[model samples]
Target: MSKTTITANGQTKNLSLEPRRLLADVLREDFRLSGVHIGCAHGACGACTVHVDGVPRLSCLTFAVQCDGAEINTVESLGGDDAHHLLQRAFREEHGLQCGYCTPGFLMTMAPYVEEMAAQDRMPEDAEIRHAMSGNICRCTGYQSIVAAVRLAITQRRNGESTQ
Candidate 1:
Protein backbone atom coordinates (compact mmCIF):
# COMPACT_ATOMS: atom_id res chain seq x y z
CA MET A 1 0.00 0.00 0.00
CA SER A 2 1.05 3.54 -0.67
CA LYS A 3 0.27 6.56 1.47
CA THR A 4 -1.01 9.62 -0.32
CA THR A 5 -2.54 12.90 0.74
CA ILE A 6 -5.39 14.54 -1.10
CA THR A 7 -7.67 17.45 -0.38
CA ALA A 8 -11.17 16.42 -1.47
CA ASN A 9 -14.30 18.50 -1.07
CA GLY A 10 -12.31 21.00 1.01
CA GLN A 11 -11.23 18.31 3.43
CA THR A 12 -7.71 16.92 3.50
CA LYS A 13 -7.23 13.22 3.92
CA ASN A 14 -4.27 10.89 4.18
CA LEU A 15 -5.12 7.45 2.87
CA SER A 16 -3.36 4.14 2.44
CA LEU A 17 -4.27 2.55 -0.84
CA GLU A 18 -2.88 0.45 -3.65
CA PRO A 19 -0.56 2.38 -5.89
CA ARG A 20 -2.56 1.48 -8.97
CA ARG A 21 -5.96 2.21 -7.51
CA LEU A 22 -7.99 4.52 -9.68
CA LEU A 23 -9.00 7.92 -8.35
CA ALA A 24 -12.63 7.11 -9.10
CA ASP A 25 -12.42 4.06 -6.90
CA VAL A 26 -10.66 5.93 -4.15
CA LEU A 27 -13.21 8.71 -4.18
CA ARG A 28 -16.21 6.43 -4.36
CA GLU A 29 -15.17 3.40 -2.38
CA ASP A 30 -12.78 4.86 0.12
CA PHE A 31 -14.16 8.31 0.65
CA ARG A 32 -17.83 7.53 -0.12
CA LEU A 33 -18.04 10.34 -2.61
CA SER A 34 -20.64 8.61 -4.74
CA GLY A 35 -21.01 11.51 -7.11
CA VAL A 36 -17.87 10.42 -8.93
CA HIS A 37 -19.56 7.87 -11.13
CA ILE A 38 -17.59 5.19 -13.00
CA GLY A 39 -19.34 4.38 -16.21
CA CYS A 40 -16.77 3.45 -18.88
CA ALA A 41 -13.75 3.05 -16.59
CA HIS A 42 -11.63 3.54 -19.73
CA GLY A 43 -11.85 7.35 -19.63
CA ALA A 44 -13.59 7.69 -22.98
CA CYS A 45 -17.00 8.39 -21.46
CA GLY A 46 -15.93 11.13 -19.04
CA ALA A 47 -18.45 9.81 -16.53
CA CYS A 48 -15.91 10.09 -13.77
CA THR A 49 -14.76 13.63 -14.40
CA VAL A 50 -13.40 15.55 -11.42
CA HIS A 51 -11.31 18.62 -10.78
CA VAL A 52 -7.70 17.93 -9.89
CA ASP A 53 -5.83 21.08 -8.97
CA GLY A 54 -8.59 23.15 -10.61
CA VAL A 55 -8.39 21.27 -13.89
CA PRO A 56 -10.88 18.72 -15.08
CA ARG A 57 -9.57 15.14 -15.37
CA LEU A 58 -10.94 11.65 -15.86
CA SER A 59 -10.89 10.12 -12.43
CA CYS A 60 -11.18 6.64 -13.89
CA LEU A 61 -7.97 7.12 -15.84
CA THR A 62 -6.01 8.64 -12.98
CA PHE A 63 -4.28 6.82 -10.17
CA ALA A 64 -4.86 7.91 -6.62
CA VAL A 65 -1.12 8.05 -5.99
CA GLN A 66 -0.73 10.32 -9.02
CA CYS A 67 -3.00 12.81 -7.27
CA ASP A 68 -0.99 12.99 -4.09
CA GLY A 69 -0.88 16.52 -2.69
CA ALA A 70 -3.42 17.65 -5.24
CA GLU A 71 -6.62 19.46 -4.48
CA ILE A 72 -9.54 17.40 -5.77
CA ASN A 73 -13.10 18.59 -6.15
CA THR A 74 -15.96 16.29 -6.93
CA VAL A 75 -19.61 17.12 -7.52
CA GLU A 76 -20.19 16.91 -3.80
CA SER A 77 -17.97 19.91 -3.30
CA LEU A 78 -20.09 22.05 -5.60
CA GLY A 79 -23.14 22.46 -3.39
CA GLY A 80 -25.78 20.75 -1.33
CA ASP A 81 -29.55 20.48 -1.27
CA ASP A 82 -30.03 23.65 0.73
CA ALA A 83 -27.72 25.75 -1.43
CA HIS A 84 -27.09 24.82 -5.05
CA HIS A 85 -24.42 26.15 -7.34
CA LEU A 86 -25.57 28.18 -10.30
CA LEU A 87 -24.71 25.37 -12.68
CA GLN A 88 -26.69 22.89 -10.69
CA ARG A 89 -29.62 25.25 -10.43
CA ALA A 90 -29.46 25.94 -14.12
CA PHE A 91 -29.32 22.25 -14.87
CA ARG A 92 -32.43 21.71 -12.85
CA GLU A 93 -34.19 24.73 -14.29
CA GLU A 94 -33.26 23.74 -17.84
CA HIS A 95 -33.98 20.05 -17.39
CA GLY A 96 -30.44 19.24 -18.35
CA LEU A 97 -30.60 15.72 -17.03
CA GLN A 98 -32.94 12.80 -17.61
CA CYS A 99 -31.54 9.67 -16.05
CA GLY A 100 -29.02 11.86 -14.22
CA TYR A 101 -26.23 9.32 -14.50
CA CYS A 102 -24.03 11.74 -16.41
CA THR A 103 -24.99 15.00 -14.72
CA PRO A 104 -22.14 15.10 -12.23
CA GLY A 105 -19.48 14.52 -14.84
CA PHE A 106 -21.06 17.07 -17.12
CA LEU A 107 -21.12 19.60 -14.30
CA MET A 108 -17.51 18.96 -13.41
CA THR A 109 -16.37 19.21 -17.02
CA MET A 110 -18.27 22.41 -17.80
CA ALA A 111 -17.61 24.31 -14.58
CA PRO A 112 -14.17 25.61 -15.54
CA TYR A 113 -15.37 26.68 -18.95
CA VAL A 114 -18.27 28.57 -17.43
CA GLU A 115 -16.00 30.22 -14.88
CA GLU A 116 -13.46 31.17 -17.53
CA MET A 117 -16.09 32.60 -19.80
CA ALA A 118 -17.61 34.46 -16.89
CA ALA A 119 -14.20 35.94 -16.05
CA GLN A 120 -13.83 36.96 -19.68
CA ASP A 121 -17.28 38.56 -19.46
CA ARG A 122 -18.56 36.63 -22.46
CA MET A 123 -20.93 33.80 -23.15
CA PRO A 124 -19.75 31.05 -25.42
CA GLU A 125 -21.38 30.46 -28.74
CA ASP A 126 -23.28 27.27 -29.34
CA ALA A 127 -20.42 25.79 -31.34
CA GLU A 128 -17.92 26.71 -28.67
CA ILE A 129 -20.12 25.19 -26.01
CA ARG A 130 -20.33 22.00 -28.01
CA HIS A 131 -16.58 21.92 -28.44
CA ALA A 132 -15.95 22.48 -24.75
CA MET A 133 -18.46 19.78 -23.78
CA SER A 134 -17.20 17.24 -26.29
CA GLY A 135 -15.46 15.24 -23.61
CA ASN A 136 -18.59 14.34 -21.72
CA ILE A 137 -21.44 12.20 -23.13
CA CYS A 138 -25.03 11.97 -22.04
CA ARG A 139 -27.35 9.30 -23.32
CA CYS A 140 -30.41 11.25 -22.35
CA THR A 141 -31.52 14.87 -22.94
CA GLY A 142 -29.83 15.03 -26.37
CA TYR A 143 -27.45 17.73 -25.04
CA GLN A 144 -29.74 20.68 -25.79
CA SER A 145 -30.72 21.10 -22.17
CA ILE A 146 -27.17 20.66 -20.98
CA VAL A 147 -25.97 23.35 -23.33
CA ALA A 148 -28.79 25.58 -22.22
CA ALA A 149 -27.88 24.99 -18.62
CA VAL A 150 -24.29 25.99 -19.28
CA ARG A 151 -25.43 29.09 -21.08
CA LEU A 152 -27.71 29.98 -18.24
CA ALA A 153 -24.92 29.57 -15.72
CA ILE A 154 -22.63 31.73 -17.79
CA THR A 155 -25.28 34.40 -18.04
CA GLN A 156 -25.85 34.31 -14.30
CA ARG A 157 -22.15 34.64 -13.61
CA ARG A 158 -21.71 37.46 -16.06
CA ASN A 159 -24.59 39.34 -14.46
CA GLY A 160 -22.78 39.19 -11.09
CA GLU A 161 -25.34 36.81 -9.68
CA SER A 162 -24.45 34.34 -6.98
CA THR A 163 -23.04 31.17 -8.52
CA GLN A 164 -22.20 29.33 -5.36
Candidate 2:
Protein backbone atom coordinates (compact mmCIF):
# COMPACT_ATOMS: atom_id res chain seq x y z
CA MET A 1 0.00 0.00 0.00
CA SER A 2 1.04 3.52 -0.69
CA LYS A 3 0.13 6.65 1.24
CA THR A 4 -1.02 9.62 -0.78
CA THR A 5 -2.70 12.96 -0.29
CA ILE A 6 -5.13 14.33 -2.82
CA THR A 7 -7.23 17.48 -2.79
CA ALA A 8 -10.56 16.34 -4.18
CA ASN A 9 -13.59 18.55 -4.56
CA GLY A 10 -11.96 21.11 -2.27
CA GLN A 11 -11.27 18.56 0.44
CA THR A 12 -7.84 17.18 1.18
CA LYS A 13 -7.90 13.46 1.80
CA ASN A 14 -5.15 11.16 3.04
CA LEU A 15 -5.42 7.73 1.49
CA SER A 16 -3.64 4.41 1.85
CA LEU A 17 -4.20 2.41 -1.28
CA GLU A 18 -2.61 -0.20 -3.52
CA PRO A 19 -0.15 1.36 -5.90
CA ARG A 20 -1.65 -0.33 -8.91
CA ARG A 21 -5.21 0.74 -8.19
CA LEU A 22 -6.79 2.85 -10.87
CA LEU A 23 -7.59 6.42 -10.00
CA ALA A 24 -11.22 5.84 -10.98
CA ASP A 25 -11.40 2.96 -8.52
CA VAL A 26 -9.81 5.03 -5.80
CA LEU A 27 -12.23 7.90 -6.36
CA ARG A 28 -15.30 5.74 -6.54
CA GLU A 29 -14.57 2.79 -4.28
CA ASP A 30 -12.35 4.38 -1.71
CA PHE A 31 -13.67 7.92 -1.56
CA ARG A 32 -17.27 7.14 -2.56
CA LEU A 33 -17.19 9.74 -5.28
CA SER A 34 -19.61 7.85 -7.48
CA GLY A 35 -19.68 10.55 -10.15
CA VAL A 36 -16.44 9.22 -11.60
CA HIS A 37 -17.79 6.43 -13.76
CA ILE A 38 -15.62 3.68 -15.26
CA GLY A 39 -16.40 3.06 -18.86
CA CYS A 40 -14.17 1.14 -21.28
CA ALA A 41 -11.58 1.09 -18.45
CA HIS A 42 -9.16 1.97 -21.22
CA GLY A 43 -9.32 5.76 -21.46
CA ALA A 44 -10.85 5.66 -24.95
CA CYS A 45 -14.16 6.67 -23.44
CA GLY A 46 -13.95 9.81 -21.37
CA ALA A 47 -16.61 8.65 -18.93
CA CYS A 48 -14.06 8.70 -16.14
CA THR A 49 -12.77 12.17 -16.90
CA VAL A 50 -11.61 14.27 -13.94
CA HIS A 51 -9.54 17.36 -13.44
CA VAL A 52 -6.06 16.63 -12.15
CA ASP A 53 -4.21 19.83 -11.29
CA GLY A 54 -6.80 21.81 -13.30
CA VAL A 55 -6.35 19.70 -16.43
CA PRO A 56 -8.71 17.04 -17.61
CA ARG A 57 -7.43 13.45 -17.46
CA LEU A 58 -8.79 9.96 -17.82
CA SER A 59 -9.00 8.47 -14.35
CA CYS A 60 -9.13 4.94 -15.71
CA LEU A 61 -5.74 5.31 -17.31
CA THR A 62 -4.19 6.90 -14.20
CA PHE A 63 -3.11 5.07 -11.06
CA ALA A 64 -3.87 6.21 -7.56
CA VAL A 65 -0.21 6.70 -6.76
CA GLN A 66 0.30 8.78 -9.89
CA CYS A 67 -2.13 11.38 -8.52
CA ASP A 68 -0.37 11.83 -5.22
CA GLY A 69 -0.30 15.51 -4.20
CA ALA A 70 -2.54 16.35 -7.14
CA GLU A 71 -5.55 18.58 -6.89
CA ILE A 72 -8.44 16.59 -8.33
CA ASN A 73 -11.84 17.98 -9.27
CA THR A 74 -14.75 15.71 -10.01
CA VAL A 75 -18.33 16.59 -10.99
CA GLU A 76 -19.04 16.97 -7.31
CA SER A 77 -16.91 20.06 -7.24
CA LEU A 78 -19.06 21.76 -9.84
CA GLY A 79 -21.86 22.59 -7.39
CA GLY A 80 -24.32 21.39 -4.84
CA ASP A 81 -28.03 20.52 -4.66
CA ASP A 82 -29.15 23.96 -3.49
CA ALA A 83 -27.39 25.75 -6.32
CA HIS A 84 -26.06 24.41 -9.59
CA HIS A 85 -23.14 25.83 -11.46
CA LEU A 86 -23.83 27.76 -14.64
CA LEU A 87 -22.67 24.82 -16.76
CA GLN A 88 -24.94 22.49 -14.88
CA ARG A 89 -27.84 24.89 -15.19
CA ALA A 90 -27.19 25.32 -18.87
CA PHE A 91 -27.03 21.58 -19.38
CA ARG A 92 -30.43 21.22 -17.81
CA GLU A 93 -31.91 24.24 -19.57
CA GLU A 94 -30.63 22.95 -22.90
CA HIS A 95 -31.49 19.33 -22.26
CA GLY A 96 -27.88 18.40 -22.77
CA LEU A 97 -28.27 15.09 -21.01
CA GLN A 98 -30.45 12.05 -21.67
CA CYS A 99 -29.52 8.90 -19.83
CA GLY A 100 -27.08 11.02 -17.79
CA TYR A 101 -24.43 8.29 -17.71
CA CYS A 102 -22.01 10.47 -19.66
CA THR A 103 -23.01 13.82 -18.18
CA PRO A 104 -20.42 13.86 -15.41
CA GLY A 105 -17.51 13.21 -17.72
CA PHE A 106 -18.76 15.68 -20.26
CA LEU A 107 -19.11 18.32 -17.56
CA MET A 108 -15.60 17.67 -16.28
CA THR A 109 -14.16 17.82 -19.78
CA MET A 110 -16.04 20.97 -20.76
CA ALA A 111 -15.52 22.99 -17.60
CA PRO A 112 -12.01 24.14 -18.46
CA TYR A 113 -12.86 24.99 -22.04
CA VAL A 114 -15.82 27.03 -20.97
CA GLU A 115 -13.82 28.76 -18.28
CA GLU A 116 -11.04 29.62 -20.70
CA MET A 117 -13.48 31.08 -23.16
CA ALA A 118 -15.20 33.01 -20.40
CA ALA A 119 -11.87 34.38 -19.30
CA GLN A 120 -11.25 35.58 -22.83
CA ASP A 121 -14.73 37.08 -22.98
CA ARG A 122 -15.61 35.09 -26.08
CA MET A 123 -17.88 32.23 -26.97
CA PRO A 124 -16.55 29.38 -29.02
CA GLU A 125 -17.90 28.60 -32.44
CA ASP A 126 -19.80 25.41 -33.02
CA ALA A 127 -16.87 23.79 -34.78
CA GLU A 128 -14.49 24.82 -32.02
CA ILE A 129 -16.81 23.44 -29.42
CA ARG A 130 -16.99 20.16 -31.30
CA HIS A 131 -13.23 19.99 -31.58
CA ALA A 132 -12.71 20.71 -27.92
CA MET A 133 -15.25 18.07 -26.88
CA SER A 134 -14.24 15.42 -29.39
CA GLY A 135 -12.35 13.49 -26.74
CA ASN A 136 -15.49 12.60 -24.82
CA ILE A 137 -17.90 10.09 -26.38
CA CYS A 138 -21.57 10.42 -25.64
CA ARG A 139 -23.95 8.00 -27.33
CA CYS A 140 -26.99 9.88 -26.16
CA THR A 141 -28.07 13.45 -27.03
CA GLY A 142 -26.04 13.35 -30.25
CA TYR A 143 -23.82 16.11 -28.79
CA GLN A 144 -26.05 18.83 -30.20
CA SER A 145 -27.50 19.68 -26.84
CA ILE A 146 -24.10 19.46 -25.22
CA VAL A 147 -22.66 21.96 -27.63
CA ALA A 148 -25.66 24.21 -27.23
CA ALA A 149 -25.37 24.00 -23.50
CA VAL A 150 -21.75 25.11 -23.60
CA ARG A 151 -22.63 27.95 -25.90
CA LEU A 152 -25.35 29.03 -23.56
CA ALA A 153 -23.00 28.97 -20.61
CA ILE A 154 -20.49 31.09 -22.47
CA THR A 155 -23.18 33.58 -23.30
CA GLN A 156 -24.31 33.67 -19.72
CA ARG A 157 -20.79 34.23 -18.51
CA ARG A 158 -20.17 37.07 -20.93
CA ASN A 159 -23.41 38.71 -19.90
CA GLY A 160 -21.95 39.41 -16.44
CA GLU A 161 -23.41 36.36 -14.83
CA SER A 162 -21.41 34.41 -12.29
CA THR A 163 -20.67 30.91 -13.53
CA GLN A 164 -19.19 29.50 -10.39
Candidate 3:
Protein backbone atom coordinates (compact mmCIF):
# COMPACT_ATOMS: atom_id res chain seq x y z
CA MET A 1 0.00 0.00 0.00
CA SER A 2 1.08 3.51 -0.80
CA LYS A 3 0.54 6.07 1.91
CA THR A 4 -0.48 9.60 1.14
CA THR A 5 -1.33 12.69 3.16
CA ILE A 6 -3.84 15.13 1.75
CA THR A 7 -5.67 18.00 3.37
CA ALA A 8 -9.34 17.72 2.50
CA ASN A 9 -11.92 20.30 3.37
CA GLY A 10 -10.47 21.78 6.52
CA GLN A 11 -9.10 18.50 7.82
CA THR A 12 -5.99 16.47 7.11
CA LYS A 13 -6.56 12.95 5.87
CA ASN A 14 -3.95 10.24 5.77
CA LEU A 15 -4.70 7.34 3.48
CA SER A 16 -3.12 4.02 2.65
CA LEU A 17 -4.30 3.06 -0.78
CA GLU A 18 -3.63 0.73 -3.64
CA PRO A 19 -1.56 2.19 -6.40
CA ARG A 20 -4.47 2.31 -8.80
CA ARG A 21 -7.12 3.57 -6.39
CA LEU A 22 -8.80 6.59 -7.83
CA LEU A 23 -8.97 9.75 -5.74
CA ALA A 24 -12.74 9.70 -5.99
CA ASP A 25 -12.84 6.27 -4.36
CA VAL A 26 -10.52 7.35 -1.59
CA LEU A 27 -12.54 10.46 -0.87
CA ARG A 28 -15.86 8.67 -0.91
CA GLU A 29 -15.14 5.17 0.38
CA ASP A 30 -12.31 5.73 2.80
CA PHE A 31 -12.76 9.35 3.84
CA ARG A 32 -16.55 9.40 3.64
CA LEU A 33 -16.64 12.41 1.41
CA SER A 34 -19.56 11.25 -0.72
CA GLY A 35 -20.07 14.65 -2.24
CA VAL A 36 -17.38 13.93 -4.78
CA HIS A 37 -19.47 11.80 -7.06
CA ILE A 38 -18.20 9.60 -9.85
CA GLY A 39 -20.19 10.09 -13.01
CA CYS A 40 -18.26 9.21 -16.13
CA ALA A 41 -15.34 7.73 -14.16
CA HIS A 42 -13.36 9.31 -16.95
CA GLY A 43 -12.15 12.89 -17.16
CA ALA A 44 -15.07 13.99 -19.34
CA CYS A 45 -17.77 14.34 -16.71
CA GLY A 46 -17.30 16.93 -14.04
CA ALA A 47 -19.28 15.05 -11.41
CA CYS A 48 -16.07 14.05 -9.68
CA THR A 49 -14.81 17.57 -9.64
CA VAL A 50 -13.02 18.97 -6.59
CA HIS A 51 -10.43 21.57 -5.89
CA VAL A 52 -6.79 20.61 -5.58
CA ASP A 53 -4.53 23.42 -4.48
CA GLY A 54 -7.37 25.82 -5.27
CA VAL A 55 -7.92 24.52 -8.81
CA PRO A 56 -10.70 22.27 -10.02
CA ARG A 57 -9.70 18.69 -10.91
CA LEU A 58 -11.47 15.51 -11.95
CA SER A 59 -10.93 13.16 -9.02
CA CYS A 60 -11.99 10.06 -10.93
CA LEU A 61 -9.03 10.40 -13.25
CA THR A 62 -6.63 11.13 -10.40
CA PHE A 63 -4.97 8.45 -8.33
CA ALA A 64 -4.96 8.77 -4.57
CA VAL A 65 -1.20 8.38 -4.38
CA GLN A 66 -0.84 11.30 -6.74
CA CYS A 67 -2.53 13.55 -4.19
CA ASP A 68 0.16 13.24 -1.57
CA GLY A 69 0.76 16.54 0.18
CA ALA A 70 -2.02 18.15 -1.79
CA GLU A 71 -4.80 20.34 -0.47
CA ILE A 72 -8.21 19.14 -1.60
CA ASN A 73 -11.64 20.66 -1.12
CA THR A 74 -14.91 18.83 -1.70
CA VAL A 75 -18.49 20.06 -1.67
CA GLU A 76 -19.03 18.73 1.81
CA SER A 77 -16.66 21.32 3.17
CA LEU A 78 -19.08 24.02 2.20
CA GLY A 79 -21.71 22.88 4.67
CA GLY A 80 -22.26 24.45 8.07
CA ASP A 81 -24.56 26.85 9.86
CA ASP A 82 -22.41 29.81 8.88
CA ALA A 83 -21.46 28.33 5.54
CA HIS A 84 -22.73 30.57 2.84
CA HIS A 85 -20.60 30.49 -0.24
CA LEU A 86 -21.86 32.88 -2.85
CA LEU A 87 -22.35 30.18 -5.42
CA GLN A 88 -24.29 28.12 -2.94
CA ARG A 89 -26.61 30.96 -2.08
CA ALA A 90 -26.87 32.12 -5.66
CA PHE A 91 -27.75 28.60 -6.66
CA ARG A 92 -30.65 28.64 -4.24
CA GLU A 93 -31.77 32.14 -5.10
CA GLU A 94 -31.52 31.55 -8.85
CA HIS A 95 -32.86 27.99 -8.78
CA GLY A 96 -29.74 26.80 -10.54
CA LEU A 97 -30.22 23.11 -9.90
CA GLN A 98 -32.56 20.33 -10.93
CA CYS A 99 -32.05 16.68 -9.96
CA GLY A 100 -29.04 18.20 -8.12
CA TYR A 101 -26.56 15.49 -9.01
CA CYS A 102 -24.40 17.79 -11.12
CA THR A 103 -24.74 20.83 -8.86
CA PRO A 104 -21.75 20.01 -6.69
CA GLY A 105 -19.42 19.85 -9.65
CA PHE A 106 -20.73 23.07 -11.08
CA LEU A 107 -20.46 24.89 -7.77
CA MET A 108 -16.97 23.63 -6.94
CA THR A 109 -15.66 24.41 -10.42
CA MET A 110 -17.20 27.86 -10.59
CA ALA A 111 -16.22 28.94 -7.08
CA PRO A 112 -12.58 29.48 -7.85
CA TYR A 113 -13.23 30.96 -11.26
CA VAL A 114 -15.61 33.55 -9.88
CA GLU A 115 -13.26 34.30 -6.98
CA GLU A 116 -10.42 34.78 -9.45
CA MET A 117 -12.48 37.16 -11.53
CA ALA A 118 -13.40 39.15 -8.46
CA ALA A 119 -9.77 39.37 -7.44
CA GLN A 120 -8.92 40.73 -10.86
CA ASP A 121 -11.60 43.42 -10.58
CA ARG A 122 -13.47 42.02 -13.55
CA MET A 123 -16.55 39.89 -13.97
CA PRO A 124 -16.23 37.20 -16.56
CA GLU A 125 -17.97 38.06 -19.76
CA ASP A 126 -20.80 35.73 -20.75
CA ALA A 127 -18.66 34.14 -23.42
CA GLU A 128 -15.75 33.86 -21.03
CA ILE A 129 -17.93 32.32 -18.36
CA ARG A 130 -19.33 29.83 -20.87
CA HIS A 131 -15.87 28.98 -22.13
CA ALA A 132 -14.47 28.58 -18.64
CA MET A 133 -17.29 26.28 -17.61
CA SER A 134 -17.33 24.24 -20.81
CA GLY A 135 -15.97 21.15 -19.12
CA ASN A 136 -18.93 20.82 -16.74
CA ILE A 137 -22.06 19.36 -18.33
CA CYS A 138 -25.43 19.72 -16.64
CA ARG A 139 -28.49 17.80 -17.87
CA CYS A 140 -30.81 19.84 -15.64
CA THR A 141 -32.01 23.43 -15.44
CA GLY A 142 -30.91 24.21 -19.03
CA TYR A 143 -27.85 26.17 -17.74
CA GLN A 144 -29.59 29.56 -17.75
CA SER A 145 -29.91 29.51 -13.99
CA ILE A 146 -26.34 28.32 -13.66
CA VAL A 147 -25.18 31.32 -15.63
CA ALA A 148 -27.35 33.56 -13.49
CA ALA A 149 -25.85 32.09 -10.35
CA VAL A 150 -22.33 32.90 -11.47
CA ARG A 151 -23.35 36.41 -12.39
CA LEU A 152 -24.97 36.91 -9.02
CA ALA A 153 -21.88 35.68 -7.26
CA ILE A 154 -19.71 38.12 -9.16
CA THR A 155 -22.02 40.95 -8.33
CA GLN A 156 -22.14 40.08 -4.66
CA ARG A 157 -18.41 39.71 -4.43
CA ARG A 158 -17.86 43.08 -6.09
CA ASN A 159 -20.27 44.71 -3.68
CA GLY A 160 -18.24 43.46 -0.71
CA GLU A 161 -21.03 41.20 0.37
CA SER A 162 -20.50 37.86 1.95
CA THR A 163 -23.17 35.27 1.46
CA GLN A 164 -22.58 34.03 4.98
lDDT of 1 by residue, 1-164 (tens): 98899889888899998998999999998888999999999978888999999999999999999999999999998876443989999999999999999989999999889999999999889999999999898999999999999999999999999878
Please tell me which predicted candidate would have the highest lDDT against the true structure.
1
User: Which residue pairs show backbone clashes in model 2?
Assistant: none
Once fitted onto the true fold, the runs of candidate 2 whose alpha carbons sit more than 4 angstroms away are none
- 139 in model 1: Cα distance from truth in Å? 0.4
Order of models, best lDDT first: 1, 2, 3
Error of 1 at 51 (Å): 0.6
The candidate with the higher TM-score, 1 or 3, is 1
Worst 10 residues of 3 by lDDT: 77-86
Off by over 4 Å in 3: 81-83
lDDT for 10 (candidate 3): 70
Candidate 3, 83-130: lDDT as tens digits = 377779899899999888888888888888878888887977888888
- On a 0 to 1 TM-score scale, where does candidate 2 land against the true structure? 0.95
TM-scores for the candidates = 0.96, 0.95, 0.93
Clashes (backbone N, CA, C under 3 Å), per candidate, total 0, 0, 0
Q: CA lDDT, every prediction?
A: 0.91, 0.89, 0.85
